[model samples]
Target: MPQPEDDPGSAPRAAGATNAGATPPDPATVEKLRSTIGSLSTATLKQLDADLPWYRGLRPDERSALGMVAQKGIASFVNWYQKPVSPEWVLSDVFGTAPTELTRSISLQKALQLIRVVVQVVEDHVPFLAPAADQAPLREAVLRYSREVAFAAADVYARAAETRGSWDTRLEALVVDAILRGESSDALRSRIAAVGWKSQARITVMVGSAPSEPNVGFLNELRRVTGRLAEDVLVGIQGERLILVLGGVRDPAKAYPRISELFGDGAVVFGPEAESLVAASSSAQAAFAGLTAARAWPGAPRPVSSEDLWPERVMSGDDTARRSLVRTIYRPLLAASNGLEQTLSAYLTLGHSLEATSRSLFVHANTVRYRLRRVCDVTGWDPLIPREAYVLQTALVVGRLSAPPAPPVAANGAPGTGNGRAARAGSIDKAPPVPLGRPSAL
Candidate 1:
C-alpha cells in the first residue's frame, strides 16, 4: 500500500524507535548505579556465605580473597554497564585480578554458583535503581553479561586444568628418569611423593622401542590396559625407547603378556620386581641392558624377562649380568655338595652325552643323569635344552675364571710336578658309585 509522505519532524522519532532497545544509559543513571556497587558487593558476599557450602567452607584467607573478587566483580560490572558492550573489559577488570590458584580452591561449578548469586543480587536491586520502563532492558543486559562471565570462567578453568596436566606429566617423567638412573636422593623421594608414587608396592620396569608416531594418549592407554590387570604404571618415552614402571604387580612375568601390546614392535623386556621403587634401579639396569642386547637373539620373546637375557647381556659387556650369572648360577652350584659342579663340567665337556659324561667321571650313567637332575633342581636350568645348556656352559666358564686357582696335588698322596690331571682322575675313580637303578629323587 502506498502511503503519503510524513513531516520531516517525525524522521527523528522514527530513528529513535529503531534504536530504542540499544540506547546507552543516561549519565545520571550510570552514576547512580555505580554508587550502589559497594553495597551490592557486600550483599553478594553475604549471599555466598549464607547459601554456598563451598564458599562457607573456605578458610579465612580464601574467604577474604573471594570477597575481594566479588567487590572487583561488582565494580567491574558498574564500569561495564556504563560503557558500550565490551566483553573484554569484563574479563580484564573482573577476573584478571583473581589469583592463579583460585581454581584449585574452587571448582568451576562452584564458581558458576557464585556468579549466579552475584547476578541474582544485582537483579534484585534493578527495579529499585531503574524506572519500571527501563528495568527490562537492564535485566536483559545483566543476563547477557552473566553468560559472558560464565564462559570466561570456563575458559580460565580449562586452561588451568591443561597446565596442571602438563606439569604432572613432566614431573612424572622426571621421577621415572631418576629411578632409571639409580638416583635415590631425598630429593628424588620427595619428588616421588609429589607425583604420588606408590612407594610400598612392588615395582618393575619394562623397556621397549617407542612408537614411531607420537601418541599423546599413549600413557592413558597404557594405564587403561595395565589397570585391567589391577596394576599402576609410570611411563616415560625417551626418544626411540619407551619405559614403564609397573606397580602392584605380584608377578611381572604373568602381567607382561597382558600389557605387552602397549609397546611398539620390538623386544620388550620386564625387569625383576624390586621390593620398592627405591631399589628399582637394579631392575631398571637389567631391563635396559636386556633391551639393548635383545636384538642379538632374533627369537627372543616379545616380553622376555631381563634375567632370561643374561647371557646376551653378558656378551654385550653388561657387568650386572656377569655378576648375576656368577652369583645366581655359578656360586649356588659351587656351594652345593653333591659333586654337581664336576658333573655339570663333565656333561658340557662331553657334548651333553650322559654315557660319555658318566665314563669321563667314573660314575654310572644313571648316577650322572641323577646329578644332572640335581643341577637342574639347584639352578633351574635344564641341561637337556640347547639354550639352557648354553647358559650353564657359559656360567661354568665364568665361574672358573672368577674363582681362585686350585692348589696342585699329586695322584698318589704325594707332592708332584705341577700337573693335577692325575689327581683329578683319581678323585673321580675313588668316589662311591650310586646303585644302578632309577635316578635318585632330588
Candidate 2:
C-alpha cells in the first residue's frame, strides 16, 4: 500500500534536509567574516569589559588569554560556515586556542559570559559583514555556533573539575601519610601548601575504624562537611583505619559529638592539639595509641580524648601517658596543700574508708572529706569515683617510679632509717606502690 510519490530522500538529501531552511553562509560572506575576525575580536573584548563586571578584574595575562579565546572563536565560526558540518571541533577550535592554564583561572559561568559577548558582537556586525539577502542565514549561523560553544564550555569545565579533584585527593593522601610518618620535610611542607591548608596553629588528629562499606563518595562528603567545621582538614583512608587531621579548631567541645558519630562502630579517639601541622605527629601518635588501647576501657566514652585514657594508655605501655600521669596527678598533688596527697594515699590504702583514712592521718573525718574534694579540684580526678581512683593509683605508681626520693637520715645519723616504706603519699617518707584494690567500703 506504499504511495509512489511518498518516497524518502537519499542519505545525502536526508542529511541535508536537517538544515533545509537555514542555509550555510555564501563564500563572499564567509570571506568577509574571516576578514573581520580581528574587528569582531576587538569588539568582543570591549563588550566583555563593559558588560561583565568581573572581566576587568582579571589579571592582564589572563585577560589576554581570554582575548585569544575570542579571536579563535570568530575564526572557528568562519571555518564552520564553509561546510557547516557537525560541531565536533568546538572544544579544540575555541577553547583550545587559550593556554591550558586558562581554564583554571576562569570559571565555567564566566566562560559562558565571555562566549555570550562574542556571539553578541558578531550579531551586531552581521549587517556590515553580509549583504541584505545574506543577513538572515549569517545570523542563524552565529546562533547555532554560539549554542555549540556554550555546551563545549560546560563539558570542558566538568572534566577540569574531575581532574583537579583527583589530583587534590592524591595530594591530600600524601600529606596525611607524611604527617603520620612524622615527616616535616621540605617536600611535605610543599605538599601541605599545595593542599591549601589554612591553619598554622592548633592542629589536631582523630582516628577510628573505616566503614565496613568503604566509599570514595563518603570520604568526599566527610571532607566537605569537616571543611566547614575546621579551617583546614586532611582525610586518609588506609586499609581499615580512617585518619583525620583538623586545623584551626582550638576547642572541639561542640564539634566532636557530631563528628564522632561519623565514624564506624568502634571507639573514636582524638589527641590534644599541636602547634602546627608539622608538629601534628605528637597528636597523631597519641590518637593512634589511644585507639590501640581504647578496648581496655569498655565503657569509655565514644570519641574519648587520648588524655582521658591515661590509665589504659599507661597499662598499654604508652610512655607519654606515664609522663602525663606524673605531670597531671603526681606533680600537681606534690605542689598542692600538704594534706591532699596524704589524704588520697590514706583513703586508698585504708580500703577507701573515710573513717579509717581520718584515723590514719589523725585528722577528723570532716577534714578528710574536705581534703578529698580538694584532690578532685587539683587533679581533675575524683578519688570517690571507683574508676578515677584506679587512674589515680596508677598515676601514683608511675609518679613514684619516675622520681623516688632519697632515704632520710635518722636522729642517730643513720641513713635510710627514719621513714618505713609503708604506702605513704606525698611524703619524702617511704611509700610502696599504690594498690589498685579497695577495702570494700564506700
Candidate 1 residue 139 C-alpha distance from true site, Å: 1.6
lDDT of 1 by residue, 1-442 (tens): 1111353421112211122357887677678788888788889999998989889889988888778777877776666666644354445466765746568678888888988999999999998778887788788777776876776777778878899889999999998999988999999988888887764677888899887885768767777878766456788989999898888875665678878887888999989888888789988988999999999999988899988888899889998888888998999998996899999998898788999998898989999989889999999999889888888988888778888986666766677665778668767899999869888799
lDDT of 2: 0.83
Candidate 2, residues 1-442, lDDT tens digits: the string is 1112233421111123135445556889878888888888888888999999888998998888888888888888887777666565667777774635667678888888888888989999999999999998888888887887777787788778889889998999999999899998899989988999879887899999988987878887887778777888898989999999999874588777677877888999999999989999989999999999999999998889998888899989999999989998999998996778778988999889999998888889999999999999999999999988999998888898899687886444567545434223235455567779867876
Q: Quote the lDDT for 367 in model 1.
A: 97
**Model 1 residue-pair collision total:** 0
Off by over 4 Å in 2: 1-24, 97-99, 405-413, 416-442
- Stretches of candidate 1 above 4 Å error? 1-21, 26-28, 227-231, 250-254, 349-370, 410-442
Please provide TM-scores, in order, for all candidate models, with all chains considered together: 0.82, 0.84
